[model samples]
Target: MATSSNFFIHTFLISSLTFFPLSPSLADDDTDKPVVEQLVDTLSTIAGPHPGIRKNHAKGIVVLGEFTPSAEASSVSSAEHLQSASTPVTIRFSNTTGIPDIADTNPSSFPKGIAIRFQLADNSYTDIVSISVNRFPVATPEDFLGLLNAVAASGPDTPAPKPITQFLASHPAAKTFVEIEKPAPVSFATQPFYGVNAFKFINKEGEVNYGRYQIIPVNGPEYLTDEQRAAAGNNYLFEELPKRLKQNKAEFILALQLAEKGDEVNDPTMVWPETRQLVKLGTLTIESIDPNGEQFAKQTMFNPLALTDGIEASKDPILLARPSAYAISYGRRLSGQ
Candidate 1:
């Protein structure tokens, strides 16, 4: 018996709203529909760039956090002991809404976590990253910035497009984002960050397969509320991280979320229902810690493009634009302005 599943939730069906310029030579409209994802070709007129908001975010870096994934099977370590077979690990942790100096105690900020690129032993491909953030970019680069600008912006609809600064002032959520820059109730080391990608796994049998990586905090992921913010004050967030690393072993496991075909391609808004099942890939425990000074922070770059093989990018759009922007930003920092 054949079965049907709509799976097309509004958030996921968002691809329906995106525009992709395919080769116009298609014989007919029916033929023009994409086999992977079906979206309206007319998405351009309905949409304009939604300029994402950026607060010239500046935090110090860890000279120790410096390590890149290699195309070969290597190990993750420092000047001393070498351990686990190292894959390229591009990790980033940030509060979605934050200014330079704010308390790290706000749950709404969703201290964003990242570990984009990692290599497999043979290095045929890379593990996909940001399949969770937004979807269209994987389809085309334009969607990443396009959809972002739309969501974050008030747009050209006004008699005059208000400067983003003005629009953000009107939108309280935007302001709250900056106010709660580092809102971590306890220590950020406790939160569980996701690697929202449906990876393609293949075997020597010429068969194809799929999966994703999961990072579970061994001890944390504490959430802070508004009331907690008034008491904690600004330095509280920065204070908690090192305290956790010092008091507890503060470790997280890297696991995999294997996938079958056609999981919810719609509601790009919800997390792709992971079985939440995890397979142990590696472990990340804060060993030697350092200060968040300008030298360590300013010089670092986190680009999604720099991945090792075995992991593959999915048919999502937002994940597409990161590499270019990240590389440019990385180069700018290295240039030492």
Candidate 2:
């Protein structure tokens, strides 16, 4: 009685971020199209087409807030937002899958998402996009494309060692990425979010250090028991966020995990050790839910590469590919796909 949906849910829960390397021989006919377009297409194949929403993280709720920079923030980055002034921000919490109406309690929605946009002076903005799961699976778009193909080919009737299984066998980092436990959070405010990609942070004196972002909830992460999750409504996470904010502001510590010499800066799969130094960048206080958030969520796009001065993208291929993939999805959304 298994279904493709069931298979996808199981496989996707392993790691919503990406998959293993795909072989050229198995390339789809659409290979002629841009890889970004192919990624968008493959995501639709796996998650179904949902019009007027993002191709990934389609189901989300937007919240408004402000970011207060830490005293040490300027020591690591000269970015204007990291300076003395408080910056207004927009934050969106979402499910990993592209299915807009996916039940919040579903295992497929386990690794929740957070996208934070800081609005700076003169109409400039910077964004940080993260998932509750701390790392990414693949290094390049082609590898992710292959993983997507594997998942698309995997179904309930598929033979032993499904494509995803075989993929995990060949790719150790991806295997580890999928094996990480991801439980549903009691509420969006209760979860921690991580920026998996490394970035170059430049200080006022022009010194540079590679670091990854860790957004930890001030109260720390809290998960639901199976019984509680099952008893929760389909939109429980979203509904709970607004009500939580009304009672009091939700807060998170924004910090960077600095990479030591010889650390892998260009590979997202290579997570730096916990023993690495953590620089407290600032505090993000989410204050209110946007009444028009849903409409804004449909139209706005959050790009990790949409960075400001003092923050630059690493050469990580996955990080580099995100903007193009996001652009394709954004266009499709506007066209009512």
Candidate 3:
């Protein structure tokens, strides 16, 4: 239903995994290839439906100064920032691995990555950044090989018999994050994790530092139920987006959580919880979008690597993988320009 480049972060990486885990055949489920195979097949189908969105798929992963936020939080009050929200923003949302011609109305689809840019006070812009629903780095570039293994190990559609228990089956390093260890259809209820790939900070004085960001859904998190996900609509948000955004506004508040220094490095599999509740940084609202209309289909970019000065990225491994793949796909979409 959506397409973008800043939105591109998930396009390349996620589309690559529309597969089941690899494992010896289960009695009734021994008919599929490695999960990676299915994932690739699924993506090949959704990668080319929207013309403009696809064009945007052809741009830069992230340009250093284009849209980074200040290194530190500003003296600007959160209230002021919220009040300043009058500055309207336009965003492009798209499923990175959706099948071509897929119906946006389906609930089983993967989340469309989000790429957002704001017109700042100085008229400068912020680089596009992707906000994904899945927080676990299991899907990040850092977990590539291991993720492939999970899909390789399990059968498609067969939820690992013992989710928490099976997740523990992979052993520590067998999987990138605890998430992938989770057999099939990780629940949004129990596992709403983020790549926490990269981030930037803003100082009231306008100083900036690169950083990482993640969210822990407010409702203890829940994944789509079995029936709602039948049409490959494994995740219900797929069905919810069109409905909510059409009703005037769609909003998701993501508190900002920064990675403290001296912690793990390039460890995309790590999890940082509410032990440090996210700093209430901002709220994302989608005023309204015509799921199949021109504006949503054309004119929106969403490369997660895109950013503003107050939000620079780091040399984090997963963060680093974005530029090339993101740029190529985004460029192809924007090439005629």
Tell me, by TM-score, which candidate is best. Answer: 2
| All-Cα superposition RMSD per candidate | 12.4, 2.9, 10.4
Query: What are the TM-scores, per candidate, against the unseen true structure?
Result: 0.56, 0.92, 0.57
lDDT (Cα, tens digit) per residue for candidate 2, span 1-337: 2475447435464326632223223445666778777667766765765777676788889999999999999999999999999999999999866788888987677578889999999898999988887888777777776665666566778887778778768988867866677777888998999888899999999999999999999989999887887799999998898889999999999999999999999988888889999999999999999889988888888889999999999999888888888888889999998
Give per-residue lDDT, candidate 3, residue 312: 52
Clash totals for all candidate models:
41, 0, 94
Model with the higher lDDT, candidate 1 or 2? 2
Cα deviation of 156, candidate 2, in Å: 4.1
Candidate 1 regions exceeding 4 Å error are 1-57, 60-92, 96-99, 102-111, 115-185, 203-207, 264-270, 291-296
Error of 1 at 38 (Å): 27
Per-candidate Cα lDDT values, in order, are 0.38, 0.82, 0.40
Alpha-carbon runs more than 4 Å astray in model 3: 1-85, 102-108, 121-123, 131-195, 205-211, 214-224, 231-242, 246-248, 290-300, 334-337
Strongest candidate by lDDT = 2
Model 2, C-alpha of 73: deviation from truth (Å): 0.6
lDDT assessment of candidate 1: 0.38
Per residue, candidate 1 scores C-alpha lDDT tens digits across 230-279 of 67866665566666556655566665555545664322323446464445
Q: Which scores better on lDDT, 2 or 3?
A: 2
